[model samples]
Target: MSIGASITVVAVGAILSFATHVHSSGFSVIAMGGVLMVVGIVALCLQIAALHRQRQMTAAEVQPPERTVVVRPPSEY
Candidate 1:
């Protein structure tokens, strides 16, 4: 997921975990929230790592021009 989406997931998860008090008969909202938070964090980290790798690759692809030298013969008297 993108950074914004990841952050949104984390925010939603926090809201669910800490702000809400609803209890379901067959599911745990808090647990789900925690899971979402973890997923969000992991996704964010992965995205950051991927971006860093891409930047490194791009930098490596660029190179400066090679220098060249030339010699001329001496003029005859």
Candidate 2:
């Protein structure tokens, strides 16, 4: 996932975990939120690592300009 999406997921998870009080017999909202937060954090880390690797590859691909030699003809007397 993208960084923005990851962050949004984390934010939503935090809100669900802390901002509301709802009890359900089927599933736990807090647990779901916590899982979302963990997933978001892992995705964010992976995205960052991928970006960093891409940057390094890009930097490595760049090469300096090639040098050229110029020759002069002998001057006529």
Candidate 3:
């Protein structure tokens, strides 16, 4: 999903670039390109952050527990 979203952003950015090249006047085209580029970058960053977080969580689960024993006294001997 993230990959597809990123691809779509890039495609839109390309289209904006082409539009700006041909029209060369409307400010909207430049703004649209910038917005699309930012979206792609942010999406990529989020994906990387998510993977890193998952990896860290998994790694943490691997080590043994810090406090293992719970003591309780039995009834009268």
lDDT values for all models: 0.91, 0.92, 0.79
Off by over 4 Å in 1: 69-77
Superior by TM-score: candidate 1 or candidate 2: 2
**Residue by residue across 1-77, what tens digits does model 1's lDDT show?**
89999999999999889999999999999998999899999999999999999999988888666888688899899
9-76 per-residue lDDT for model 3 (tens digits)? 97788778666664456567767887887888788788888889999999999988888787888879
TM-score of candidate 3 against the unseen true structure? 0.57
> What are the TM-scores, per candidate, against the unseen true structure?
0.81, 0.82, 0.57
User: By summed lDDT, which 10 consecutive residues of candidate 3 come out lowest?
Assistant: 17-26
Instruction: Give the CA lDDT, 0 to 100, for residue 54 in model 3.
Output: 91
Superposition error at 8 for model 3 (Å): 3.3
lDDT of 3 at 64: 87
Best by lDDT: 2
List all candidate RMSDs to the true structure: 5.8, 4.5, 6.7
Ranking by lDDT: 2, 1, 3
Please state the error at residue 46 of candidate 2 in Å. 0.2
